[model samples]
Target: MRAKVTVMLKNGVLDPQGEAVKSALGALGFAGVDAVRQGKVIELDLAETDAAAAEATVRDMCEKLLANTVIESYGVEIL
Candidate 1:
């Protein structure tokens, strides 16, 4: 099974990297962009065959280590 996890900062959290990227985009003449948020994607291959089980496993990984649940939120997809 394959799973994908997306980890992103929760709203109201400070995102310095996102800010820097936004500034750079404006400097490069992309003025239409009003905001930017940065996040991470993790793809995993698992031995588990069931979609439900794979998704649950990935979500556990995110809660335990992949994401800092206090300041970040994560989504899991089974593929």
Candidate 2:
């Protein structure tokens, strides 16, 4: 099984890196971009075969280590 995880800062949290990218884009004359938010994607190859089990395992990983649940949110997609 394959699992994909996306981790992102919760809404209302300040994102300095995202802001820097946005500013840089504007400086580069890409003025249409009003905002930017940066996030991470993790792809994993798993031994688990069942989709439900794989998704559950990945979500547990996110809760335990992959994401800082207090300030970040995560989603899991099993493929």
Candidate 3:
């Protein structure tokens, strides 16, 4: 099984990197972009065959170390 985790800043959180990208886009003449948000994706190859178990394990990983739960939110995809 394969597990993909997406980690992103929670709503209302300040994202300086995203802001910088947005500013650069405007400077590059792509001014239509209203805002930008940055996030990370982690792809994992797992031995667990059960979809439910795999998701649970990945969720645990996110809760424990993959994501900072207080400032970020995570979503898991089983592939």
Candidate 4:
């Protein structure tokens, strides 16, 4: 089974890095740009038998290691 995980900072959190990128964009003459936030995606190939089990495993991995849930949210999709 294949799993794709996306981890991102929750809304309302101050994203200084994103802000910096936005500023850089403005300096480079990118007009009408608002803001930017950075996040990460993780793809996994699991030896698990089924999508349900794979999703559970991926969620566990996210909660345990891949993500910091206190200020972030993650979604898992099995393919």
Candidate 5:
């Protein structure tokens, strides 16, 4: 099984890195840009064959270690 996790900052949290990128884009002549938010994608190859089990495992991983859970939120997908 393959699992994918996307981790992103929750709404209202400060995102300095995202702001920096947006500013840089404006400087590079992409001034029409309004905002930017940065996030991470993690792809995993799992030995588990059951889709339900794999999704549960990945969700657990996100809650335990992949995402902070306070300032960040995560989503898991099975492929």
Candidate 6:
């Protein structure tokens, strides 16, 4: 099965990268983009098929290595 892990900074965390993107968009004449938040997308090809087990494993992976739980939150989706 394939899984996508989306890791995003918690609210109140500064996102300089996102800010840069927003600035560039504004420069390109994009209107109404008041703010932006940056996150990471990770795609994995795993052997797991059980939804609950896969989610748990990915959550563990995020907490252990992929994401900083102190400053970020994660959501996992299976495909």
The C-alpha lDDT values of all candidates are 0.94, 0.94, 0.97, 0.91, 0.94, 0.92
Model 6, CA-based lDDT: 0.92
Candidate 2 C-alpha lDDT tens digits along 1-79: 9999999999999999899999999999896897899999999999999999898889999999999999999999887
C-alpha RMSD values across all candidates? 0.5, 0.6, 0.6, 1.1, 0.6, 1.0
| Candidate 4 colliding pairs, count | 0
Q: What is the lDDT of residue 34 in candidate 1?
A: 84
Once fitted onto the true fold, the runs of candidate 2 whose alpha carbons sit more than 4 angstroms away are none
Compared with the true structure, what per-residue lDDT tens digits does model 4 show for residues 1-79?
A: 8899999899998888889999999999999987799888999988998888788889999999999999989999898
- Pitting candidate 4 against candidate 6, the one with the higher TM-score is 6
Off by over 4 Å in 1: none
Q: What is the lDDT of residue 64 in candidate 5?
A: 92
The residue-level lDDT of candidate 3 at 10 comes to 98
Identify the superior model by lDDT, candidate 4 or candidate 5. Answer: 5
Model 1, 60: alpha-carbon shift in Å?
0.8
lDDT of 5 at 19: 98
TM-score, candidate 6, is 0.92
Candidate 2 positional error at 12, Å: 0.6
Given candidate 3, what's the lDDT at residue 66? 99
Answer with 1 or 2, whichever has the higher TM-score: 1
* Top candidate when judged by lDDT against the true structure: 3
- Residue pairs clashing in model 4 are none
